[model samples]
Target: MTKKRKKEKFYVEEGETVADCLNRMAANGYQPVRRMEEPVLKEVKKNGKVDVEVSHQRIMFEGKLKEE
Candidate 1:
């Protein structure tokens, strides 16, 4: 029989380091399997035209439960 796998998302908090997030996950018996980052974007319009586009980066981790 094969063990079922589970996935969960973790968001990095302000002032928190990636290592800190990984350590916290380890304490909860979960290990990070993937890393993902997406851009948070917004458009600014002025005088019926797009003036500028702004973007920010969001970091997330996908974790799976550790096998005993």
Candidate 2:
């Protein structure tokens, strides 16, 4: 019988590279199942108008525990 897969999300911290995060996950016996990225937007008001600006990008990694 196969066990249910478990998933978790991880973020890339400041001064930390994506590779570092992935390695950390692997060390915990998890493998990356999916990769995601999104933009962090901020609202700016100028000239009686509002605009959305991308302040930074968010990197996310979804991992599933390996069944050993």
Candidate 3:
């Protein structure tokens, strides 16, 4: 038979804020990751006026997420 990988469970007590939860996760040996912001596009011009433009953007928190 193949072996199963172990996973740790996360839980919150009576009351906790986002900061508190993050702190708990750090205490448990979790790493912080960088966040990605939406991209901006340059406006196009037509007949010396404003024209249409398209921009693709996304928000991502890369790497493993911390739990508390």
Candidate 4:
């Protein structure tokens, strides 16, 4: 049998709540060990100049495999 990863990263999908993401991790036999958020950057042109802005925050979780 293939070895399963001890740790994995999961992203909160669009339209999904944080609780929903946790539930998903539990369903996959993993427990969340850490939560993180990072800004999503986007570029916009204004008056022939490009400006970078934070579009949104991306939520992610670090999961560890549950011990049986």
Which prediction has the highest TM-score against the true structure? 4
User: Among these predicted structures, which one has the highest lDDT?
Assistant: 4
Model 1 scores worst on lDDT over the 10 consecutive residues at 1-10
Error of 4 at 21 (Å): 0.5
RMSD of each: 4.2, 3.6, 10.1, 0.8
Off by over 4 Å in 4: none
Q: Which digits, one per residue and each the tens of the lDDT, describe model 3 over residues 1-68?
A: 65322333333333655466556656655544654555556688888998657565433332344443
Question: What are the runs in model 3 whose C-alpha is more than 4 Å off?
Answer: 1-6, 31-68
TM-score of every model versus the real structure: 0.71, 0.79, 0.30, 0.94
The CA lDDT of each predicted structure is: 0.83, 0.89, 0.49, 0.97
Off by more than 4 A, model 2: 1-5
Write down the lDDT that model 3 would get: 0.49
lDDT of 1 by residue, 1-68 (tens): 66545777888777899999999878877899999998877888889998656577778999999888
Ranking by TM-score: 4, 2, 1, 3
How high is the lDDT of residue 56 in model 4? 100
Q: Who is ahead in lDDT, 1 or 2?
A: 2
Q: Which candidate do you rate higher for lDDT, 1 or 3?
A: 1
Residue 35 error, candidate 1, Å: 0.3
**Count of backbone clashes for each model?**
0, 0, 0, 0
Q: Is candidate 3 or candidate 4 better by lDDT?
A: 4
Question: Which tens-of-lDDT digit does each residue in 1-24 have in candidate 2?
Answer: 665458878888789999999998
